[model samples]
Target: RNDHMLSDWFRKNQEVRIYLGYAPEPNWWSVADLVHVFTGKIDGISPSFRNSMTCKIIGRDYSAPLIDTSFTVAYAARTSSQIAKMLAGKYGLKLNITDTSEIIERDMYQNRKEWEVLQALADLEGFICHVDKDKTFHFGPRQESDEEVEAELYYRSRLKSNCQVDFEDTAIDVYNQITVRHYRKKQVIEGSAKNDALIEQIGQVKERVIYNSKAKTNAQAKEMAQKLLPEFSRYVVTGKAMNMAGNPNLFCEKKVAVKGCGRFDGNYYVERFEHTLNSSGFITNLDLTNLRPDTAQQYRQDLYTKDSAILGSGNKLGSGTI
Candidate 1:
């Protein structure tokens, strides 16, 4: 393509590294200031021989294969961190995870994708999983977003001109109560969590019930539901906060607060974001909550991947609420 030797040299399984860098203020830029943002492999390449010759290339982050490409494995009452390490090591990726005491019940993926199993485990424990540019896999409880940092951003909105809301969306899945029912050795066990304050404010209980949970005990089931209560509370205010006023630090998995925006004033999880810099200056775009379809797909697969029996006796297994 481009008649450049390197551009046409792409082949299967070749490593790729990408870095993002900028000058630090008035100081001259150096390689030390660069941040490694992506590491991947050339999973595919296609050269077109048309009138205007061109080429197409596609790849994924390095940890993708490590997480998504494995097969048959089993775990019985294994701890969360233990399983994470095992999976990472299997693929030769470095593991960076917070240890968890949560023990997962017996499970067999039956040759399913490794990510499906990990995602199922994550949902059951109300945790999260991700990887870094160095192929370092991470798993554990989701980190709490800094409210003070988010406050600083909203405060700067009045001064910055480009910071304006571009789009917003709200999900109807917001609920005050989450009920989880699972089959425990063929007996139905149930656990539920309630947000009394939310129910009171809404004037009624908006409930979401999930069947075939992976939780092994009543407490585990309840804890899974409890973790979702606060997340759903924030859904009422989910929406993209137009252009943020200042160059504020923002990233996925972080929480941002929008204020002085009427009913939209509330904390929201920054699910996705984009940053652009040019002669026009820097711009920040954000996607909050379920505005993006990937979040919806993730929820569907993560919550329902585990094998479970039907809600009642003498019935067949089927997909349940996620």
Candidate 2:
């Protein structure tokens, strides 16, 4: 009869292949025994049958299995039954009462320690509710409602008070639930406006000149001065001279006062025309007319030579006499 039942299950070649790979042990007891043992049915079996059962039953009056290997067949059967049940539920398939009974029996015969752990986890419920209503499962008020101002505080208190729960695990559970509910909505609404405004404001700010003014050493100061000189050149003597002397004119056409030149004199002095012109502005002539004849001629020659060389190199002389 068992062989006929097996043959009926494997009418198709594919089914036969599957069955060949999954051949049940000949020595194995029927699913009834597994289900009975799984559901605390050790006493239902005769003394001889119980002794022969692969799993070593242990513990006081309750014969819990000491060896895990004995429950292997039972565990596999129970898991397979659970999977079938889940598939049936998902697809709206009709499940037989006999199949359900077999599953229950198998589960009862499984290892007690593992079964206890599975039951504990199955019974557990996290405090926080997911934001997505469809995904959320609500239990009785564990601590507080989501709308309550002090809900988090209350929930945290309950979690800490639960001796069986670890603080980190509880916190993680609560956080995951809350985030799933609120994070997406908050990002779509509040974040959108803030992000748009920030980008728009940045676009409105004008890009103008930038200055760094903490220049300290002489080299740094010189670089800063060079940069500033062009902007302020219109208000300075160098710019005035450059404006007066156009092309190749080696001297200023009009008289301009040089400030901060002397320790004593505050007035401008009249002098003959002798200055060098270049792109960097103007180099004024040093007064040598009042000096001794030989010394004055030597000084004038030296000035001419230096100014010629500077002009030939296409350098701009600043508004200062040598």
Which candidate comes out best when scored by TM-score? Answer: 1
Q: Candidate 1's residue-wise lDDT over 185-250, tens digit each?
A: 457677899989878877888886654335778887798778756765544333454454323355
The residue ranges of model 2 lying beyond 4 angstroms of the native Cα positions read 1-63, 66-322
Q: TM per model?
A: 0.66, 0.12
RMSD of 1: 8.6
How many clashing residue pairs, candidate 1? 6
Cand. 2 Cα-lDDT:
0.23
lDDT of 2 by residue, 1-322 (tens): 2322332332211200000111156486454332111112122211222333322221211112221213334444443235333323332323331121212334444444432322221221111111111211222112322222210111123333211110100111000000001112112111100123323544442211211113324355345444433322211111111222211222211222332222211221112233343445533342211111111111222222232322222122112221
Q: Model 2 misses residue 39 by how many Å?
A: 15
TM-score between model 2 and native: 0.12
* lDDT over C-alpha atoms for residue 175 of model 2: 9
Summed backbone clashes in each candidate are 6, 9
lDDT of 1: 0.56
Which parts of model 1 are misplaced by more than 4 Å? 1-5, 25-28, 45-57, 73-79, 98-108, 144-159, 167-171, 180-189, 194-206, 209-235, 241-249, 277-282, 290-322
